[model samples]
Target: MINTILPKPFLFLLLILICAETRAVPVPPAAVAYTADIIIYGGTSAAVTAAVRAAKDGKQVIIVSPDRHLGGLSSGGLGFTDTGNKEVIGGLSREFYHRVYMHYQQQDAWMWQKKEEYGNKGQGTPAMDGKERTMWIFEPHVAEQIMEDFIKENKITVYRKEWLNRKNGVVMKKGRILSIRTMSGKIYTGKMFIDATYEGDLMAAARVSYHIGREASAVYGEEWNGIQTGVFQHGHHFKKEVDPYKIPGNPASGLLADISAEKPGINGSGDNKLQAYCFRMCLTNHPDNRIAFPKPDGYDPLNYELLARVFQSGWNELFDKFDDIPNRKTDTNNHGPFSTDYIGMNYDYPEASYAQRKKMIKAHEDYQKGLYYFMITDPRVPANLQNRLKTWGLSKDEFKDNGNWPHQLYIREARRMVSDYVMTENEVLGKKEVPKPIGMGSYSLDSHNTQRYVTDKGFVQNEGDIGVKAPVPYSIGYGAIVPKKSECKNLLVPVCLSSSHIAYGSARMEPVFMILGESAAAAAVLAIDDQVAVQDVSYEKLEQVLLKENQKLRFGK
Candidate 1:
């Protein structure tokens, strides 16, 4: 009867509109509440090792990971491990490499190339050492699978893709964190917390003291803490003078892209600048498993103008860092003066909002992708170099979900905690003996170029690339992982532990992160059992458990 009063066509149209409105409305999922004895808030190698250790110790553990995939950079792209002294690596860290070794033993693991055909290349050691029973180098997918195997064997609970609400997520009472909430409205309550993220988001939100940029050399009585304008230890600086202006030798025209007009800061002085960040691309030349480098959206040639000039200067070191991995793949990294390191573009990433950081990450991806595309397509590149680059492409068998691009960017340095005893160059250089030894680091004190600015001589140059090798294996103290007693008592920060920028450079390796992660979990278990703050845990008790768990705390102990 109602349809008879109105036009049939109008009635039908109104019904359609009503149905569309109804479909547009979304129903939100209910908030989840989880309680655990220990809650780890990251998806890095440290997070997985921490969760495994906690679960092994008979403690209920939960991993609230922002990442959909496990193993941060270890599984992301850096399959070529950076093991300083393999003897110093112990506990779950060594177990990971052992697993890699076991996997490579199967003939199926050698898909692209035969096991004997792949040479044993590594960082001052064999890639697959039979005597040691460890394989330091591997593929991205293999590493992820091992991490998955770890959690599965340990029966650890993990909630992936849950980002921490940095603003009002961390709830603290009486100098201890009670619980934390994620962006998905899920609440996680724990007696002890571990901030294993490279960004240190939970640690920062909990009102813990931290440092973003380099500290002055005088601040901690160290020589390599701050800016280094002229020192070039890694040969990444421009060997030849490259003009910085749009029109060569003419200062009147604007400066070329990627060449800053600012003066290189005074050496040994402090600034808010941070080390460069880029993706560790996994590439291969096998035609069957290669996807040509994509021309990302908003491709621009000007971004790599400086690199072209470097090529023109007879600098053909672009392939210097294409370190080989299994299956004939490469773990490509920043090499030349103007390579993949997006210099000076990540200074604000340490404290940026989530949305802003994603934009920055996307910008880095675009810049790097454009660099590869430019190398292959640009006329400025040498014909021979371009031809050789054409042989290589992104590994089709790797990172298949995101078009063969790595999901995690290499965040070399970020917010580092500032606890009571900060590790400095002195501690890393073996000048001072550590008090409560928890782990060991023997890598070089390495920091990539922080900025690219014009020198007073009117040539573009890179600054902040310092590489100082440690004299011997140095011990990392327990105080470096826990926060101050007054700030937060129950939180342990392993990946972003208390260290100077120079000290962190040596200790930030993936193997070292796992060592600290396992040690931190042992301490957390002890603290929870004693019903005390993490800082109050007895070092003797922690050392006993670490040694029992096969964690190499001291050099020869």
Candidate 2:
């Protein structure tokens, strides 16, 4: 017999190495193919609208969503519905809000608070319209219900928790995707594809060119495309002067943990930094349905010492952004200098690995939770403010799985496709005409702070927050949605369509995304019918379909 005896230590070592190697190897499961006329990737509000509209057009559609939840931010947590010119939102987008209005009409919809008790304020318009029967703002769960209704009503197939296999995920032939396999080894084959993800994961994986972070103003020939350090247009920026050093008034003591000591880039220059991200927490003052903010693990009071200093400077505008929605809850957003937007922390998230992204998300959660906890419990915060804040907590009914935190992080902007036509600030601000209008957008060019750093005088300051109003409701071009014909022929990118950073801020609104989603789906249907690449779909035909579908393409047309 062959000698098989080995030292006990050698045998144990061999077993250990084998286990490590086995764990390290990525064993992609055998793929199960699901073919359809159209394949939409993402669980965003845009994804739902795409699937819905495609089905309405008598096309077999499937949504292979990375998220278990369907409606992205609209259902995930952002229920406030950022509507600049609500009139521009038409078609299935408006239909969705109409459904929300219809749902609230039912007596049982008012579970947490009575309908009459709700406020009249919403986007500066009447929140209720018993006549029109359409509600604009709503609770998180209500929005999720609306998205689910669309899927159920249309019988659209959705694969939840199906992540795209980033590496070797997309199989293409002659600049067209043959099929895409998910992380779980499920293959999705479709005639046409729509990338509705916030991150544009599918778009990037298909070998299409995309730009992340800010582009210099020179590239887009616009004023707001790049960095703006001195311009502080929003209230969330630092208004009080506080030293950024660990020791008061001493640079030698070193900067605070999160504060970058390096100089923020020159104004109007391009940089890889992205805007800060945070959860649009659905907090409520309702006693019965409130969970007191728990002290999260790794809570550090020193991290927010600057906020305490701001409070000491007699700043008491904490509740300025506690915009009230229906029920007893508030769509609490980043307001003061040191509010929910975890500044200068998520620059790597646009291209981070999934595991790294999870860590980043968890870090943000812990930071925000700790902020709330400190606000309510710490003595440094004024007693009056403490008492005022104590009444607010995460809604007990929202986000039941993860301690009431929102399921989606506010991924404001990510990888934008370098497509045929890049929408710039000039087009968004109505200085230039959109050649082929598909959808309309009127939201201001709004971008959250990208970084918080020490100024020349060693005082803390925020950079890259802007809110420039538009001259009129501007049109979105079809070229913006379709990738460059040479890059990828069949893919339509709606969420992260071709645009400069500033213009994307206006176009990134949920309603606008849904509108673009439907338009993209309609384009896909047309492409499939005509047997053409997405770029070759005739604008005239696309217009007829969009208008017939009640897509509001322009301001007065």
Candidate 3:
């Protein structure tokens, strides 16, 4: 009662503090200007290749990248390339691997161990051979150096840490994009543009049509495009009954675990979600070159309870698929039921903004780092399993700037452009022929599980994962790179090429991206020569250029 009234002096002081806190700081935006004949707007492998090719073609080209680092995941610890058929790789993509071969020729490249001690066989692709036309498998820094060499040798103008404006800032006149603005208030002008980003942000901002999440099988007459619940192939599903409810078998007791209690969608139908994403962590066993995994802040043991259950289910085969690279380091990835992929958690990331995407990437990092920390240190983990995991640590030479973390997160899929020619499963399965070949993809139609849910028998399981090999290397159409002529005329999209989900699963490989990049550049140059939009580039002329560049359009005998 006595303290009900506030003192006049205290009130005045509080008001003054509030005013000071609310005051805004005035700072002028930085001004930047650039002009080029061709402008590439991503920092991926494809972006680098396209910019270099354009520069090599004697076009004044510039690369504006939001990333501080180049080469995306190619240099960001995915040293074990995901190339399907090495024979199909040519031009800049093959050149990248040759540089890796050159880097390892010297004894000094083996910083941790002897060259012979390191296994040449890596994940998804074959090892490097000096005389062979194709090369794959390399170290992280080696790839980065190769890309830098490409840029330096070509003298391509590059602007790092620049992002494009997503609003009404892409200036266009007479069906050609004149210039584009960035959030930092910088403008870039060019005759032709390539939206090489995984997310297709530039294409979207330019009023081009794009898609997010997987489409239903029915939408494109695709057999494997939608929700697939009963098909579990990778040994991740539960074999025995386990309750999904909080109380053992009672539905009224509420749902258990981290899953949203929402109804699991019907099988083979569309859903507004994408597969989970994870970092491809590079680990080393060399004591001097390894950084021990640190316990993350806000660490929760419950987040990894599923992994413990996976372990308890008599699945002791841990060191089965680790692809060993140089320096006694392994490019560790998803194995068994609960591995590196934090399933069902990265649905909204494909369309999210930079700030929101950052938060999602950080969360994935925390989850994966915590998973490792918990496995090695947690008392619940089997002693045998702990001993094996304890031998591994983050590679000292890789991602040195960011606490030994891989620079790129695996963006499995993103906004695909709904262009004139959409690649489908029929083409990949060799049921139908694809005309106007620009590139080829030979990897399996692989899509990781989109969700983990409880089954009817009250057992937890993973769903939406599919892995089926393509019948043969299928030709990627030139029309897939451009939007319908009515939508956009001057844009070329390499990363988010038009394709069905199943077909994209195969076409989504990095080498394929580089191949497509080269083709896109050739088309852009041809378009400029003919004085026509990208959509108007003649297929016969484009095919001739691709063949001359040594691109494998059709599968060879």
Q: What are the per-residue Cα lDDT tens digits for candidate 1 across 48-138?
A: 9999999999999999999999999999999889998899999999999999999999999999999998988999899999998999999
Better TM-score candidate (1, 3) = 1
Task: List, residue by residue over 110-208, the lDDT tens digit for candidate 2.
Answer: 888898888857775666656766678888888998899999999999999999988898999999998999988899999999999999999999989
lDDT of each: 0.94, 0.90, 0.81
Q: Positional deviation of 56 in candidate 1, in angstroms?
A: 0.2
Cα lDDT tens digits for candidate 3, 1-557 = 36676799999999998888777556566667788889899998899989877877778888889888888888877777887777777777777777788788888887788887766675554575757734477767778888888889999888888888887769987667899988888899888899888788888888887777778899888888888888866665555445556555677876554555555689878887777778888888888988899898778887777667667766676776577777788777787667788887888887788899899899889988999998998887889978988988898788888988988898888888998788888888888888788888888888887887776666677777888888667788888888888877788999999987767888888888888888888888888888899988998998877777677888892
Off by over 4 Å in 1: 1-30
Model 1 residue-pair collision total: 0
Q: Candidate 1 or 3, higher lDDT?
A: 1
Candidate topping lDDT: 1
What shift in Å separates residue 280 of candidate 1 from its native position after superposition? 0.4
Which TM-score value belongs to model 3? 0.92
Clashing pairs in 3: none
TM-score of each: 0.95, 0.95, 0.92
Task: In model 1, state the lDDT of residue 115.
Answer: 93
Q: How far does residue 436 in candidate 1 sit from its true spot (Å)?
A: 0.5
Candidate 2 lowest-lDDT run of ten: 124-133
